[model samples]
Target: MIGRTRLAVDIGGTFTDLVLSLPDRTLSTKLLTTHDAPDEAVIVGTRAILAEADIDGSALDLVIHGTTLATNALIERKGARTALITTAGFRDSLEIAYEHRFEQYDLYMERPAPLVERDLRLEVPERLAADGSVLLPLDEAALRRLADVLRAQRIEALAISFLHSYINPAHEQRARDLIAAAMPELAITLSSDVCREIREYERTSTTVANAYVLPLMSRYLGRMREGLAGIGVTCPLLLMMSSGGICTVETATRFPVRLVESGPAGGVILARRVAALGGYDRALSFDMGGTTAKITLIDDFMPQQSRHFEVARAYRFAKGSGIPVRVPVIDMVEIGAGGGSIGRVDPLRRIAVGPDSAGSDPGPACYGRGGTAATVTDADVVLGRIDPSRFAGGKIALHPALAHDAVLTDVGLKLAMTTDEAARGIVEIVDENMASAARVHAVENGKDTAGRTLIAFGGAAPLHAVRLAQKLGIGRVVIPVDAGVGSAHGFLDAPIAYEVARTFLVRLDGLDQALIDALFADMRAEAEPVVRLGVPTGELAETRTAFMRYRGQGHEIAVPLDNAALQPDTLRQAFETTYTQLFGRIIPRLEIEAVTWTLGLSEPHVLPRPDQVAAPAAAAVVIDTGRMVEAATGETVDAAIFARTALRSGATLLGPAAIVESGTTTIVPSGFAARVGYGGEIIIEEKMA
Candidate 1:
């Protein structure tokens, strides 16, 4: 039997990464992203990679892909013209989000505008109670009248989210049928279908988000498939989801909202595997690409998961300042801090890194692609941290003079400092920004950063990994093989899976075995077909979880359940145990109630062994490279440079060293020591004083 040949592709804001895993070896490449037409880069890169490997696309058995297109559409408000259909009295639900200001003290605080305008937000006479009871009949005549309005408004997509539809989706379903019958070409989404849980605002937001991006994602997926077919590749193509799982392209098209964090989620999956392989119980995953940086916390080899997240924050990246979308996602904090992040002197003459990026079209000042703004990459180049001759493995040349001029003009002159000082300040500010974000994320998750191992990857992460680790009080850092295209590699490791969540409120003490059993049965039935599409002949793994809380509490915590039949006493004990873990104590005499149930089905995954290192060497050898500025201090230092391909297992190099690879470079700052682990990982730790 021949091992499978798989291909994985990850599309970031500024680059499209491809990884081809043959039976014996893996080939990888990185290309600048084509923002106007993302699939263009995918096709071009795919063809180039295949040609280099001397194989046709037909040699591939499977293809997996993850992209940031859907996320960018939501953040830039570039999706289709969408409308929302809701109950008569709830036309303004989106605009009236949370009914309170996310930034209370700021008088000029502005909430994100709803995707659907008030003029296009049509309503009908229909209502359902919280417990799936019908309060009012559907007004067919009114809905039929609204179809003409929709046509006149030229809406490209529609979102149907009737009141209380999470419990009873009859009204929403009927509305969709009627609208689809009238206009078969229009894309339609239902809150019940996308988010079958409580919280009216979140449900509607999710459905609207789905409808908003449906047309764009559908067309892109279809075109991508056709392109692959043109290259003689007819393999099954799976999409990475925000929840760190893979699903067929069909599911992704139907629920594009789930792909918002797909690209970043792959990095988290890779971190989990690394965590498990290295036996690191607590690890922090850091991914920094060209346009954004993402931080995820992992515990016990599992990245934290969430059912809700916001997009396009309008105020200081505060919670509740962006549009909320409810979906199963690997919880992470993302900020606009990347290689292309622009640097500027704020009003106080203090250096400020970004929440804005240059992206690929204009790139950074060093790319010499018509970009003049001072960016983090430009700073790195000015500081001599990146080799102008070796960036992107010599695919693209960097102009040091351009980097120096841009940084000098933008930051140096403004701050009355030398170009080198300004460059150092820029790198320092960006590093601090990422470190602060990681710290805040940890605190929010009831954890701290001191004792965790930092796993860094992506295009820019390895460049600043040691500095970031030091700032977080971390002593250990690991850079896995192929760290630059880490997310693409992660795509190859994802499992075929689907998850179903539904609202089923009931007190643990009043839990009826039959009712709970039926609920899970239905959820399992729904997820089975989705998972089977990818794995047709196997016993799928199953997991059950319930969202439980003390009665009258505003939020709930997830409690895992066994496969056996539900029992009130057993469920109560489980709930209490989970609650205590999260809160450090359980509420005495408080009744525990289950509000939501989730069922996940996936193909069992057997983790592969860590990357193989080269033959062990008798002793470490170091070669001094040219001088470069140490980021930790403002002084120049002589750094040893080693090609990653040349290093053998058990090799060690002292601080002020650079490990260069095809895709990225790992910089070991002063006071740090780098060792080649047995698993081909670059393990950097702080040396004892």
Candidate 2:
């Protein structure tokens, strides 16, 4: 059985969100992120939320944390001093990634520099054939000689990767032993341990990434645990993984690279849960916080999942432009379009929002912090989309004059327009930017987003969801309860789970059933301990998947298999069914090969079910507020405002209106109307002309 008192914290690039839930009620808060110590924000937010709930930290039964620290550390190159140990002649595999340029036409394209410099990428004289046969034994003397060199370099963490290590990790394990004996204090990450997959470059890069952030994550998690304990909270601290599952802190510390997408994963979870509650079959999740906006596609109440994802891409959405981390992740497209996204006039005198953010240290000009930069928040303030006095539940009073000045100086002056017009341009551009991204992502996944309901959450999503939906040609939007801290709330709904994936190349006809069984058993052995640590006493469920593709294909599509005894015919039929659905037709007469296998262990979640969920009614209230400028028409109109809590399940309110809450506000444009659902969720739909 789950505990009654639990807490969830999600630390993003700009804000730290916290939710403290008790039997009777739930309390949540959002604070600007403290970059110096992400845990500091969590502790402070936790304390504040508990105080509001009138409960001591010690009363909490569990603590769940999800953070973007790993992602930030990689993008900023702020991880510990690291080095790489690889097989001889393959030291440049990570550097010589993919061989060709990701942006081929650009002659001046610059590659993402490898984390480890050339000097630090030490090579051990060893060779292994494709079949994992030891061709040249590892030279112990030579490896020991490099010990002095590594010690002098003062490397805090080391990554060891060897050719054919996926098939046989003997050489990699030996190298790790030698290094540990020499530098016992070093944080070592082995490729076979982190990601035992094919693709030498990706494997090495994933290992290097794990090692790079190992020390930092270890320290941060330690401090978080201690900090909570000091504050009278003595509960197990679980972490949200990128795969939308909760894990023990030990598991997260071992593979912090998996936490790169942890924060966004929570948002996806929230969308999926809320989608299921509202009975939305096809929905798009738009999570817009202060630093970034994440778009995830959900079908039949399940968010899309992928085994591999890229991070820190130079070309924002370019697939191969970032470092690839082979970990279970919720598939989504993210963009630097958020409330704190900086807005500026480019050289061509065109207004542009980010790919870069102001964050919290110096937030938007309207935040009244040290920030003077014009940001999307400032534009929203200038356009009257955000109420100055009610921003952040009135925790931070906004200054409209400063916002107006920032917008006028940054955009209006550059383009010879008024502050309002410039703000309009910024909002329009950002909305279109998100819509374009959604369209691109949908096309890539063979999905059409036109008919999907937009489940908008996070601090900024509700403020922009209706407009974004309009831009996407979507007619409906849902903003769940406590939308501001949606991700943190999502953590409470997650289950104790872990996934283990490894490369085990085999053809269906030549597949060794015993080997496959052993492989899955080994994977279960690795994941069960982690899941058991989190769940302690629960029935754990196991799911198996094989990544299969036609012969000669570069990548494979995931095909689920029966957890019972596997056979060649069953595997082939499953692969063909999924392949046909994906491509409309399977390649005939081609041999099929399985490249990787993944085993997931999870405790069953007692999912919530909403009752009396229904569509928006055709009735609405005509409560009018002061005149506000119409987003599309440039002319001021009498916009209505409604208190969200005062409305019941069947109550409807038409736009142009602002549905106000303490921490979040949903803007329904004149072309739309909103109705309250049985789950207390606000559903907005377009109005017929």
Candidate 3:
């Protein structure tokens, strides 16, 4: 008999991908993203996939979803009309972020405008010390007076972030109660609830961002649930979070800020799984969809994670050019180098690719949806890298002539070159862009890409994977099954999990084990309920980490803590080890202090290991051959084409070649060879000289 049936849905900038996993086989589909009603495409796609699988929606055991809606809201500034309430004299914290210019040399640099306008940033007379002691009592009368002003401004959401609320929630909680009583209809977000950390600006920014998107996310979640039920999918609907975990809809709705990187997080999860299955100790995950390409490094089958990341950068994709949110997130670098990224010639007569995209509505010029600009897709079609008839499984027909015209007009004529040369230049520039991003990201993490295998996925990644690998000095690339919808597949592999972070500063020598134990107990009390809502019967796994740094230092490093016991000496040793690993040395005389504590609770999951395959004695038969431009040389070459489904385990083929599938195509470049693994994944490796 078949076991549980699951469906995973991912909504990206240009496409909505769905994966339906059955006991015997898996089915997948892709649809253009419906910007106006994002859920409409999902509902329709769900019905179609279910019908194709010969199953009903009622047969689904679970449904997991991840979307870029929240991130888009912040990027486009299309969220609700929100107001902020802060302690007196700190109303400018959002504007006074870091108090230093992120780009010191660029005189024309601009900072991202705060989500809450200055006038909407109201203040009340209340104060709290660093130790959670009350310096001045709450002025309820002053807070009440702001209600009229908020009403006059027609505020849809409110954010309350008082000074030092991370240490004690009394004032923030009381303020929330009072506000709820007066303005029951307003959506309010509390800093203590969203981000309980030390930095004043980051905490306030996180709270305000949460408030800004609360109403919109709440309504969207409700509509999604209703829409799913309307199609007879009454199973539990879980949501993918930025931390590579799936949580119940209720938990996700309450903390929608955690969903900003949800879609890309799923891709990392899938990469981690692929790394483990392929027995790769180090890997680089490359996910290139329609609008952006996300690159992440994986060590020991774990993706690099962070407690803080900026969003919606306003100045040249600089670090401090966006709003900072303090939450658990997978660390990665996203660049605008996807299939639909626009290509243009600058005034200097140089080729430039994007941090912008022509999303599905107009898409690429080849899509024939009214777009006139040359995009990466247009370049690919013009270069013969993509088959116009087989694009998107024939759901959408592509116009090669339109692609050639767009490329010639936008880049060729400007550069005084032919259509093929301009297209190749566009592709080469975008690949170099991605390569530079990967190199920088790896160096920033104190790692190198020399020995790491590239795990390529998403709709556009496979077409450019080998070239990217060659640029990074990587010898191997693994294109897993269902690469086009890899992130959606990852949703099915995620564990039900939740994480809680708290700020508690103390010297290592003065750390109180009893107090720390109580603190952890409280944090567990906070996170367990959230995890249990999604998984009730499984044994929960726990992980602990402390953000430690030298006394009086401005930064910290994460040190893993043991779940068994807490000892001062052990803590010091762990901190020193982690600190030394990062900086190559640690100060011996300075005392270390713990600034933040994090507790993660997740349901345990056991992954089935892939079976090993032996070497093949025979070469795979060629299905067909097509002409394509070789990456190593600028000359056109005849490349063999094979059906992925027809290639069995241990089957091998030489390049240049294309392995075609319904959802995506894997391109094996001129100097590489391809092989089929036990799990039906295509492994491409460089040819020996």
Candidate 4:
């Protein structure tokens, strides 16, 4: 069963990558993502890979997928028509946000617009005390009137979030039952079910986000299932979640908000696997696609995980300016600095690269796809960084002349510089943007990135890895085998897993062992069915967590919990131990509080152990024939181009070389040399003068 064929698909912003794994080998293919009909790209790429492998789709044991549709729908404002129902007098929570300025110095800073407009948000009379007790009874008549208004307005989806729902959930559940019974055809999302956190703004925003994407996700998954069935495939379709786990299509449709950032999560997973295999305890995973770039940190073979992320920021790098959604997400920083990001002259006459992208349909000017704007890809082509004839495994021919023309007209003419100078500026600016994001993320997590190796992947990462690494002061870089299709390949390596989170408050002064034990039991029972639906029988693993904080604090930190049943004394000791590890010292005589609890159950993972290999002795360096190329200093220098596939273990190729592969290109700047490691990972080291 372990050797059976498996299929993995990753739908990205600009391309769809498909990977087919047979018993003997693996094959991969890429196609331009069809935004108008996304399933068409999936079908075409899947069929191509299956045909290449010479196997029918029915023989596949499982099909796993990761997609950006949910994220894209929210960012582009293309989701279903949604209406919000909330507790009376709290309809303005989404608009008011936290009332703190993200940019303190700016006199005029605008907050992101709410997903649901004021007109679509209706209120009902209901109230619950903070201690899970009812204060004001729910107005059933008001709920019915809201339902009538929704029906009359033709609302496709609804979000219900009552005050204090996280504590009791009685009112929220009752409202949902009433709404569903009244309008059976409407898609509904309850705040308690989506997120049971304490913050009203975050909870309401998350529920609204879930409702907004619920209808679109349901229709898309239904179409994909039918499309696969028509092609004679009869396997269960699983979707990758932002939490770095896989769930069934049914779960995805029910909670589509979890799918946001799913595609980037796959890349982080791949980077972790590579780090473990290469025996690196810490590393940075850099993924640059056509429309965005992502950076994540990995420690001890696990990517950093967070329960908070935002979408569509009003300012590029500032936090708290975007719509916040509380979900389990692989913690990473994403920016719009991909290959197709447009370059233009700003009002200040300074050359600027983007938060705007050409995307797949119009693509970059060099793709001959009806785009006239200059982009990062166009800059690389015009600057002689990428070969005109070898992009996307030679499937697409890049027109260098068009790139030069676009740069000259749009950027160079206004800046009074040559085309090459403008191209260089664009590349440097984008690389700085990625580096700045990495630095900020590391500092926030109490990490120093200088000692970490950079693992580069995606369509655009290899093109910019050297310069980005130089900026970060990182001395080593690794380009894994099949780096271009890294995300799709990661899908084949994922484990069948599910995570469940709930809110239950407890003060440490009066610890109750029986209550805690019952909480864990209930969590396991709720998660078992969801995990079993995707995994085969008799293989599962469980992990528990507690969100702990000092009394009177508004935020909490996640602490790991032991699975063994414990007495009150033992639980108190464990809480102190975790608190000390996080904050250096426990607060003196301050009582600890447990805000919420989470339980995650997963299928047993079959991860490969790192193979022990003898260290290789230094060997004589080999130099391929060199070519003369223009350098950044406006001087011609001798550079070597080597075929990455032909480089053997311990082979050292020196400075100013281009390691060209079918899927990606790596440029080795002056004063650096690359060595092939044992696992086919290319490691670049700076040569001492």
Best by lDDT: 3
Q: Which stretches of candidate 1 lie over 4 Å from their true place?
A: 1-3, 608-615, 618-624
Model 1 alpha-carbon miss at residue 271, Å: 0.9
Q: Which ten residues in a row have the lowest lDDT in candidate 1?
A: 610-619
Q: Comparing 2 and 4 by lDDT, which wins?
A: 2
- Name the regions of candidate 4 deviating beyond 4 angstroms: 1-3, 565-587, 614-635, 648-650
The candidate that achieves the highest TM-score relative to the unseen native structure: 3
TM-score for predicted model 1 compared with the true structure: 0.97
- The TM-scores of all predictions, comma-separated, are 0.97, 0.97, 0.98, 0.94
Q: Could you give candidate 2's per-residue lDDT for residues 25-52 as a string of tens digits?
A: 8888888899988889888888888888
Off by over 4 Å in 2: 1-3, 613-624
> Per model, how many backbone clashes are there?
0, 0, 0, 0
lDDT of 1 by residue, 1-689 (tens): 11488889999998999999998889999999999999999999999999989999999999999999998898889999999999999999888999888888999988888888898888999888888898899999999999999999899999999888988888888888999999999999999999999999999999999999999999999999999999989998999999999999999999999998999999999988887777788999999999999999998787898888998788746899888998999999998899999999999989998878999978998898999999999999888788877788889889999999999999999989999999999999999998999998888767889989999999999998888988999889999899999999889888888999999899877788898889999999999998888888868889898998889999988888989878888888899888776767888998889999999999997765545445475355564486789888899988888888778778888878888887888998888888888877888998888
Give candidate 2's TM-score: 0.97
Which candidate would rank higher by lDDT, 1 or 4? 1
- The lDDT for every candidate, in the order shown, is 0.90, 0.87, 0.91, 0.84
Query: Model 4, 219: alpha-carbon shift in Å?
Result: 0.3
Across 115-154, the per-residue lDDT of candidate 3 in tens digits comes to: 9989999999999999999999889988888888988999
Ranking by lDDT: 3, 1, 2, 4
527, model 2: CA deviation in Å?
A: 1.1
Model 2 residue 431 CA deviation in Å: 0.6
Kindly indicate the candidate among 1 and 3 with the higher lDDT.
3
Task: Supply the global lDDT for candidate 3.
Answer: 0.91
